[model samples]
Target: MQEATADTFIVRIGAVSAGTIAEDGEYPGLWGAWDQDGQFMGRHASREGVAAFLASCFIVDEQDWS
Candidate 1:
């Protein structure tokens, strides 16, 4: 069996709609917040699989009107 270990990855978050950013780039998948170091700090998966994930990370917010 493969040993479980910590791994790092990158995912691009595109334009936000309804508090979620659509997926883009090589992985083309949704991602949540970022850590202090700017590393993505949440679960990532297909757009359809990340809605709840985004909500958990509180990335969803009122639309910016500015």
Candidate 2:
């Protein structure tokens, strides 16, 4: 058996929305997340998912987004 080790990574949040209004007068928005190296992690339907994924990982730099 091998011992478990944690790998550290930096995460960043991005907007997956097109930022355009639809003909129905509705705007679409989504929470997109990625790693420090600009690697695609996953697409989330809600901002909570993005935050959850980031929290699940061993993040090194928790940059101030707010």
Candidate 3:
């Protein structure tokens, strides 16, 4: 949906659900990201990777947790 990233996004480094985490990935936990509109953008193998990737073209509003 137009890659909506004009707003802040959340970068979480943990398992959101069961049986979806990769034990062999670079990051043990599941690195997932969602846009400001609560839409899941993507998942990565590393926290830094996901953060950097999302931050590249979008603004990460760490303060807007709600």
**Winning model by TM-score:** 3
- Full candidate order by lDDT, most accurate first: 3, 1, 2
Q: For model 3, how does the per-residue alpha-carbon lDDT over 1-66 read when each residue is reduced to its tens digit?
A: 122244323433242211111222334565665554655566777756666665543533433657
- For candidate 3, the 10 contiguous residues with the lowest summed lDDT are 15-24
TM-score of each: 0.31, 0.39, 0.43
lDDT by residue for model 1 (1-66), tens: 111123222223343322423343445454443432444545466543454554444443434548
Error of 1 at 58 (Å): 1.8
Candidate 3 stretches greater than 4 Å from native = 1-28, 59-66
lDDT of 3: 0.45
What lDDT does candidate 1 reach at residue 2? Answer: 14
Off by over 4 Å in 1: 1-18, 29-43, 59-66
Q: Which RMSD does model 2 reach against the true structure? A: 15.6
Candidate 1 TM-score over all chains jointly: 0.31
| Deviation in Å, model 2, residue 34 alpha carbon | 0.7
lDDT of each: 0.40, 0.39, 0.45
Candidate 2 residue lDDT tens string, 1-66: 111123212233342321211111122365554544555455555655655665454243444557
Question: Could you arrange the candidates by TM-score from highest to lowest?
Answer: 3, 2, 1
- lDDT score for residue 5 of model 2: 25
